[model samples]
Target: MNVLSRLWTIAAERRNELVSGVSRKTNAVEAVEDLAAQLKDVDAAVVLIFASPHFDKDKLADALTQNFGATPVIGCTTAGEITPLGYETGTLTGVAFPRLHFRFSSRLITNLSRFSIDDGLRFCREFVSDFGETPGWNSLAILLTDGMCRQEEALLSAMEPGLAPIPILGGSAGDGLDFKQTFVLHEGKFHSDAALLTLLATNFRFTELRFDHFLPTEQRMVVTDADPGRRLVREINAEPAAVEYARAVGCSVDELSPFVFATRPTLVRVGGKYHVRAIQKVEPDDGLSFLCAIDEGLVMTVGQAQDIVAHLDREFTGLKAKHGQPTLVLGFDCMLRRLESELLKKYNAVSELLRQNRVIGFSTYGEQYHGMHVNQTFVGVAFFDPENEEETGGEREK
Candidate 1:
């Protein structure tokens, strides 16, 4: 290729790169406008947004549709936002995937309360049929669900078989700490009892990442009485659930709050791996309400907090060493982790590390990985440059 021609190609590639932007504007239209202006230069195939629950959902949806024109858009309300500048609140953040390296297809599942495993399987099968495949490109699926739907476990389990070999990962939408309504956006509208699933094909080297800074301790308790449907534990070790948990954590029942739950999470072992079954709040009946499923006669252990900053640094460093610095890290961090960080006074340090590592997304009510709906964990996908001939060849073979 001639020197001038090569220069032109490089410039074109740079303009079509993956891009992210953030806007703290409180008005929905202004926030959308700000984000649209920042992304106007790229030929975006799709744009994913993460906005605070405080915004007017209807106005935000309309503005997004009007500003982005024909580009597809999808996202959800967040407990908090992880922008390029790091952790933020009351803001709208987004990432634009350029058409030069990516393609997308989306499906919206509504009425989650009645969604069954069979329904999820059929839904995924149809989605995959429509998505088809692209040779020499890697594929991944992202699932965003209404956090309050309480159906993530069943939905994820069902979708797993159909999306096998595609590596699905995602998070449940949050309404901050209110634990009230949560919505997922699709087709220029926000629906509370719905989920948005997207399949993305990218000509970029990428990897899935999942981690949490907690270790299962020996302290154990048994759920002797529970309401599985509502995820309520009325009794533990045959005693009042909240009282027993407080005793286990060396605190009083009255002092049991979100921060305490964040610092001392409950874990369950599945497939030889411990996953956090986070507590949402203490119920009026003194039962312990959970963010995930609970069952009678289930054994649970308390988890001890580790050094989050150190653990995060190690994980990000290892990612860089293996992938040679990702262009962007699409992250789904659990809100409990954020609460724990604030309690430990390590929020700034963690935010700085996120900024340095190019992480962007939102703090979720829960996270999904490999068909499991988990809590108190950070789940993400890291996208690296595909320019290296060796790396491109390696990805194609996979």
Candidate 2:
């Protein structure tokens, strides 16, 4: 007998304020392990894991790999992780699933440098096409890349011209260890300098995402001098690159540092509209660099239109209206965005809302949408029936 999403069971726990403004949690494994222990027993899945700076890569990977070996894991390092139990600080929180009825597929490219745009479009087209064949299928792309890679825009650009109107979402991955390296986990392996793409298909209806959180607050600056990647190693809008960036965020070059670059990144408008190509690093010669493709002559502005909180509130409210309370939430929140959130006064209120809502996701360096990588964004999918049936909030249990 089909279960009407049936005989539902749940597993959830939270440890609040553990470390680095992070919280930890694990379900299925902790509470529902007895029910969903066999990987083959499950149909659809979700996972949440956290690693602290206190632990090194090997230990963190080994521990997580031990508990969540069979699941296709997609998450980024975070200042903290949120769960129904509360927030987990400086801990590795993991949740697993072995029984659920739905559809999902995950694929990865080991090295994007060798992978071409053709390969990307082919993958997205193929994945989405397959999901379309499923009954009641709604699609989303959960993409993760080595945060250091600056290929998101080019990659998305390459795929867009050919694919149907597919809205991609997900984030750049990070190693909980540091901002320097990011990783993705699949089949018990922790990948460094790689990208993971998860295509989800469920009967659940979703939201129509419009990019916001930033506006052209300042005049566009032309990058007169630059390198091959189009980095402005000399000036922006006719001023030292550092000056424009520091000026926008309200700081001084002497006081400006790499840490500043991470938390307060700038965006360059590419291909007519402003795509989120954030300044990933600053040069010693006083130039700025990016994590995605940028070309000289590209006019960039210190972007500032809306705060993320306002943008997100609008997005979430829209989702709630479209599908009511979500059945499942898979969030890719940028790690840098998490830091900016902490610096902002509303961080506590924001995390609490997610906690109360029972959202399970990891912090990322950047995010993925449809089939492309993006930064300073929150990419997610909320499950619900289009008709607003019985409002089965219990499916969110474990």
Best by lDDT: 1
lDDT of 2 by residue, 89-174 (tens): 45554444322334566766678656678877777678666656454444555566666565665566655543455456666655
Give per-residue lDDT, candidate 1, residue 60. 99
Candidates in order, TM-scores: namely 0.95, 0.73
- Per-residue lDDT, model 1, residue 374, is 94
lDDT of each: 0.91, 0.55
lDDT of 1 by residue, 138-213 (tens): 8899999999988988888888898887888999999998989999999999998998999999888888999998
By summed lDDT, the worst window of 10 consecutive residues in model 2 runs over 11-20
Regions of candidate 1 where Cα sits further than 4 Å from its true position: 1-11, 389-398
Winner by TM-score: 1
| Model 2: how far residue 39 lies from native, Å | 12
